[model samples]
Target: MRILVVEDEEAIAEGLKFNFEQEGYEVVVATDGHEALAAVSQTDAEEFALIVLDLMLPGLSGYEVLRELRQKQVMTPVLVLSARTLSEDKILAFDLGGDQYMTKPFALREILSRVKSLIHRHQSIRLSTPAAPADPAPAAEQSSSTQGSSPGRFQFGRVIVNFQTFQVSVGERVHSLTTLELELLKYFIEHQGEVLSRTRILNHVWDEHAEVTTRTIDNFVLRLRKLIEPDPSKPVHILSVRGTGYRFLPFPSSQDVTDEEFAE
Candidate 1:
């Protein structure tokens, strides 16, 4: 697998490259956002499996680079490594389609683990997805798994998720999903209607080695709501269980959601 590490600090950038190379990955280092973009654009024939980006950069800011990548439909998974620890900063990264965000002064082991997971998961998702279908799946197959497809599509409400292309169709709007978003949505679908605790969701969706909090799961759930729910403020498919976790109802009815259990 190949990885692109975009960081202005030469020491940190070289350190990451060495470690990743030792792990048998082809690593490329970009010291600024402009270089990062150039490397990405020029590598069409040999696509990168993952990107580790630093928000603080000399050329275009990390945010600008990320925005441009997503705008251009570059779906390479990005792992944002920044010193900024504010909740808004993390949210902004996710909003810009980052798969994961880690604070600076992080453990090297954790970074390695995250990189491994990101590449592995991305490959799995891509392999599972079929080429775009000629016709929309039949209704009966839509609610459940596509009768005999590998990692078939899943539907709830007016939303249709094409796992192969990582696209979610909600009513008339279509959104390209990040790796994290795709996996979480799949997890929810596989265990629909069950109240899943934040910890369990985290450990299962993200590996147990991930040093992240349950709050991360909540942020992702909030993101998913904006995509799948007709009204995010009043969710019907994804419900919050008072003090527990969340429940996904593929075909929600009046009895499936009570006033007391909708997500915040």
Candidate 2:
């Protein structure tokens, strides 16, 4: 797998590149956000498996790089690394469409684990629903457990997602999600209530051959909640796991389920 390491800290950048290469990945190193952006533009989306970004850098910041990339429709999964650990900072990264984020002072083992997980998750998504496979039978009642048999739409509470059209609706407003966001939401619905780590999301959502971090996952979730949650500020459905990662609270599956139960 080919991966990009974008960081101004020479030692840190070199360490990541060296370690990633040792793991049999092809590494591309960028010293600043501008260079990283240029690398992204020069490379095709299907080429590199992932990008590891640093928030603070010379020329442009990591946030800017991410924002611009998304604006230009770049979909390469990105893993953000920075010293900023504030919830707002993390939330901001999510708003810009980062796939995951990680703070500084992290262990090499943890980084490796995250990288492996992101790659695995992405591979799983690609495999799970291969390009609208041949029709199994006439369409009928569809449930989360039943693969590909429902009308394109799934509705619960104020949320509505159309699998065939890849559209999302929250309350009365309909919004379009990027391919990554759509896939992430589908995965969330399939495994609701489970606390998932950054590694786990990356393994299932991003390409398995890609390199990413947990922070990227947080960012994706933030973006997701902003669109789906009744109020992103006091999100009830997409609960946080404090310092760990995230979990999804599925809609009531039984009569005994309560509102709090559906959200918590």
Candidate 3:
């Protein structure tokens, strides 16, 4: 697999390139955000299985590069490495569609582990997606009633989620959910009404060597609430269990109770 290493530090970039090359991956180095953008644009977005990005750069910030990539619908997995260890910085990175974040002075072994895990997960997701039909069906024959209500869809409250497309419709606004958010939500849906601890959540959602704090999970849950809850401050679907972690109540009482409420 090919990997892109975007870092302004020449020594760090060279080191990463060498290490990734040693692991049998074609490594491409981009010294700055501008170079990174150029490299990504010049090649097929899927040509690189993963991108290792640094926050500080000479031409443009890593945040900007990430934003532009997502804006262009480039869905390649990105693992952000930065010296900025602040929680806010990490939160911003994830919110901006980063697949993973690592604070600097990080171990190379851990990064390698995360890279392998992310690539595996990404490939699995891609493989599981059903391909389009070889013969096209006429638009007139298509059914609108079951358009977004497939088996891969989940609807609750004012939210309609199509897991296949990662498209979420909340009320009148439609939003594209990040991979982590979608995975977290899928996990919650699969284990509805069960209280999940932070450790379990981390084990399930992130790699074993992923350098993320429990508080980061809380932030992600908060973001999920903002997307699904009518009022994020007073969430009903993803309820907090006091000293414990969280409980996923797929059929919250606030909405009209029905046997066919949760995802089928």
Count of backbone clashes, every candidate in sequence: 1, 21, 0
Tens digits of per-residue lDDT, candidate 2, 1-264, equal 898889899899899999999999999999987888888888785577778899988999999998898777666667788999887777787678776668888889888877776655555444443222232234564344433324555555567777544467776787755556878887777766677766788887765543345666766788888888777876766677655666766442333133443333
Candidate 1 worst ten-residue window by lDDT: 129-138
Residues 29-104, candidate 1: write the lDDT tens digits.
9999899999998978237989999999997999999999888878888999999998888888887888888998
lDDT of all predictions: 0.81, 0.71, 0.78
lDDT, model 1, position 137: 38
lDDT of 3 by residue, 135-201 (tens): 1335674444533234567665456776666667887887766667777877776677777998899
Instruction: Estimate the TM-score for candidate 3.
Output: 0.77
Which candidate would rank higher by lDDT, 1 or 2?
Answer: 1
- Winning model by TM-score: 1
Predicted structure 2, TM vs. truth: 0.61
Lowest lDDT block of 10, candidate 2 = 129-138
- In candidate 2, clashing pairs total 21
TM-score of each: 0.83, 0.61, 0.77
